[model samples]
Target: MQKEYTVTVYTEDRIGITNRITIIFTRRGINITSLTTAETEIPGVYKFIITVMSTREKLDKVVGQIEKLIEIHRAFVHEEDEVVYQELALYKISTKSLESGDIERLIRDHQARILTITADYFVIEKTGHQQELTDFIKKLEPYGLIEYSKSGRVAIVKWSRRFHEHLKELQASSEA
Candidate 1:
């Protein structure tokens, strides 16, 4: 059975690494639902959080191919329960909508924050799971949603001790 999986990849920060990683999915015809990449706690190392819907068997093979890349330190495929994650979404609504006081109530109810208010529009920010963000958007549409965007997932594995130890070992080896 096919289910959603989050593939986390750790790699050296180098040009073309993103392209190389995406190409692996492209060749296998796996569609990426979302992809987020950013530097890690370890300097010169970066992490990629990719969401896709695929079978565990196929995902394992994909992770193996990703690990074969020279720049990649490690790659992992995690079920949803194996990690903690969040995504950020921003909504821009007309300033006029704020007059009703309902907008403030909505923000407070959803635990969202008003990022900025201006003559023309106000921006609201929410950080949560994908469903929560989308539900917030639905509620905001009636209040004059001018625009909205959501980021890819950012996640930390539940059991990351092994990865951190691996990084420490690499640092030690490099210093020798």
Candidate 2:
């Protein structure tokens, strides 16, 4: 059966690397649910976090192929349970909706907080799983949701303890 997987890749910062890495999935008919790229602790190095739905066998092979890319240093595939992930969502609603005060209750119940309140709109921020963010949207629909934005999945492998060790290994290998 196919399941959600988060593929984490460490690589050197270079142009077109994102396109090159994503094409591998595109060719395999894998649809990416989320993609996030950012700098790593190491200077000139970067990390790519990709979320996809596929079977373990296929994902293993895909990860192998990703590692073969010239710029990729390493790639790993993780099951949902193996990683702790969150997405940040911001909701902007009309200030007129607050007169009822029900919106305040809903935000507190959902563990979301108001970030800013202007004469026209108020913004609420929530950080959680995808389903939670979607649920919040449903709850806010009655409040005249002006804009809703969410960030890509940011995750950390629950069992990862070798990150530093792996970085050292990469450094040593690059030096040799």
Candidate 3:
């Protein structure tokens, strides 16, 4: 059965690394739903958080191919429940809308914050699960929502003890 999987990849920060990783999925016709990349706790190492819908069998093969890349340190496929994750979304709305009391109530109810207010428009920021962010979008539409964007998933594996140990080993080996 096909289900959503979060593929976490750790790699050395190098040019073309992302292109190489995405090409693996492209060849297999797997559509990446979302992709986030950023530096990790270890300097010079970066992490890619990719979301895709595929069977575990196929995902495993994809991960293997990713691991074969020169700069990749490791690649992991995790079921949704196996990781803790969040997505950030920002909404731009007309400043006029904020004048209404109902809009204030709505924002407060959703626990979203008004990031900036100006004469023309204001920005609202929200951080939550994908569904929660989308739901918030729906509520803001009637209030003159101008634009919106969401970041890809940022996640940490629920069971990361082994991962930490592996990183330590890599550091030790590199220092020798």
Query: Which is the winner by TM-score between candidate 2 and candidate 3?
Result: 3
| Colliding residue pairs in candidate 3 | none
State the weakest 10-residue window (summed lDDT) of model 2.
159-168
Which ranking of candidates, highest lDDT first?
A: 1, 3, 2
List RMSD in Å for every model shown: 0.9, 1.8, 1.3
Q: Over the stretch 99-135, how does candidate 3's per-residue lDDT look in tens digits?
A: 7778999989988999999899999999999999999
Model 3: per-residue Cα lDDT at residue 114: 90
Worst 10 residues of 1 by lDDT: 163-172
Across residues 133-157, which tens digit of lDDT does each residue of candidate 2 receive?
A: 9999999999999999999999888
lDDT of 1 by residue, 98-175 (tens): 999988998999999999999999999999999999999889998999999999999999998888888978988898
Q: How accurate locally is residue 152 in candidate 3, as Cα lDDT from 0 to 100?
A: 93
* Residue 53 error, candidate 2, Å: 0.9
Give lDDT per model, in order: 0.94, 0.92, 0.92
TM-score of each: 0.97, 0.93, 0.95
Off by over 4 Å in 1: none
TM-score, structure 1 vs. true? 0.97
